[model samples]
Target: MRTFNMHEAKTNLSKLIDETVNGGQPFVIAKAGKPLVKVVRIETEAEKPRRRIGFMKGQLKVPADFDTMGADEIADMFEGKSK
Candidate 1:
């Protein structure tokens, strides 16, 4: 942890932010020798909400021959056959 005075923090805000995010070092900003705020990286992705996979599970049905269902038609089109 490091503490930066108001003027210094303002001047090096970008660099301080980079260090906080990339180096995982948090810092504090002070005004008139009193702490005003702390700069830290937000929670990582693992701590944030994630998409719910398989939310539609059981709402759709798949045929046993799903993979080959359109095989014949696709082959016919490629062979210039119509019907």
Candidate 2:
């Protein structure tokens, strides 16, 4: 990662972008001597999708007839037509 102060970052944005895109490195731009925002390369479509394995295990249960709802029963819930 490379760090750039606000002035240099604003004045040389084009070079910064080129470096970010071609070099595939992240950068941080700071202002008032304080660390600020960051820029990084984006994942391409061919990249593997990120998954959280077993993140939801045993957290949810299947509901029987979950897809089956009468028209009036569904509409009444949305339109407050059911008591």
Query: Taking the tens digit of each residue's C-alpha lDDT, what string does model 1 give over 1-83?
Result: 79999999999999999888896689999999999998989876566767999999999999999999999999999999999
The pairs that clash in candidate 2 are none
Root-mean-square deviation of each candidate, in angstroms?
Answer: 9.2, 12.3
Candidate 2 lDDT for residue 8? 94
Give candidate 2 misplaced runs (Cα > 4 Å).
46-83
Residue 11 error, candidate 2, Å: 0.6
